[model samples]
Target: MGLRSLQGRSGLVTGAGRGIGREIALGLAAEGMNLALLGRHSATLTETLHACVRHGVKCVALAADVAHPGQVKAAVDSVRRDLGGIDLLVNNAGQVDRAEVPLWEADQAQWWQVVETNLRGPFNLLHSVLPGMVERGSGRVVNLNSGFALRPDGRYTAYATSKAALLRLSDNLAETLRPHGVTILDISPGAVATEMTANMPMFADMVHWGSIPYLVATVVDAARGRLDPLHGRFLHLGRDDLEALLRDAELIRERDARTLRLRPYGDEDPLAAYS
Candidate 1:
């Protein structure tokens, strides 16, 4: 498929109040896409809203906790009413573990909060908006995933587990929604400099950081349908060569690469079966 223009399209970006989400919202706005920014922080959402408005695109800031179904429903209704339905949905809102602690030692409330915010938050938003997207027969979804999802990190079990589940959710949704012209992708912005990372002591010694522009460009490409061929696959900003991936889309599909799957003990293992 040819690259599609995003001009005049409508999108909803969760956690658009600050950090990577803010950058993504502004980037989409620069492409002339109308936006509905959803976040818990009113002040930061207002800041992002102004930044998006400066790009001359229709934008609205809605203060809502994505984990709450009622709030998500209200926000989705507002976006549909104001922007004429959503063509893009970015599930960027997430929560990290409050501290580096073992699963057994971590505060139960904090642990569950991370899980609910990162996982259920996306579920809430999707539940509210997916019906409209499916009805329209055209839509895009980008779920911000993490490297932790692929690797086991004992210190942040909740975050790792939630992101891992989210990646699987994207893969499953992609298969279900593909025939409807809706593409779902998982994007991992590895080690980007953000308030969330800065607060994590584990990353204090990290010298190399992912480029925000590169991540934003990846999101923009996904939003414009340039990545439809690789839909349901995982893409890493500042690491993966997107052009090469696009060129080898068929091979990746054939190999079933970049997706989560259960590995069998041996080639003859019956438990290793996959479709």
Candidate 2:
């Protein structure tokens, strides 16, 4: 896993219309990989596809809502037919609630919508896309995760809860994929400035924004096997040092750090092992 070429590989990227997803799509395309761009808006998807094709790689844009099971299934079918096969999947589509409010005051439908897009969207893609990967014996999945998944936030409960569950999904799925030569990982883009971020009251005082180019490069690294050491763990671009983490991979795994888990009171606690 020290080095591998992404040339000739094919991938599917959800929410490829704009922002981080579009950058990632272009990054992969530049590396000579074929791409299938998925999102709800066809016009934006077309724009991304145009940009991706300029990299001189095969590309297609398919419009569909990732949150809907049927739509995702159909889109995946098109990917299989158009791109030949999906070697890597980037689950980048997500939604946020209306405002930073308490759970009781949050709009019920909007809360659930956020959860549906962030959590169920990934579930639908995994379910529809994983079987083929398992059968082939090698694959990679990159779920665009968030820091909120690591802690609780009453102000953004829906986003926090869904991301937390998604992280758990990767934790367990990694074990299942290991024997099959597949890997799943979680990564947070680190408070990147976007329309979504500008609207959030939490980042009003922010000065620096995370680099989308760096995030795209990291995603490419994962596909090229440079980050195979971190297959199941969380990678927070803002907080983690890539070289340090890679060099200390064994120590990190030994301590089971950088993952979501319950902490016990002390080593003497009877439930310490489980925690």
Off by over 4 Å in 1: 1-5
lDDT of each: 0.91, 0.90
Q: TM-scores across all candidates? A: 0.96, 0.96
Candidate number with greatest lDDT: 1
lDDT of 1 by residue, 1-275 (tens): 11325788999999999999999998899888899999999999999999999888899999999889999999999888899989999999999999898999999998999999999999998899899989999999999999988889999999999999999888888778988888999999999999999999999999999998888888898888999999899988757989999999999988989998887888888887863
CA RMSD of all predictions: 2.5, 2.4
Model 2 TM-score relative to the real fold: 0.96
TM-score of 1: 0.96
Task: Write the residue-wise lDDT of candidate 2 on 74-111 in tens digits.
Answer: 99998899887789999999988789999999999999
Clashing pairs in 2: none
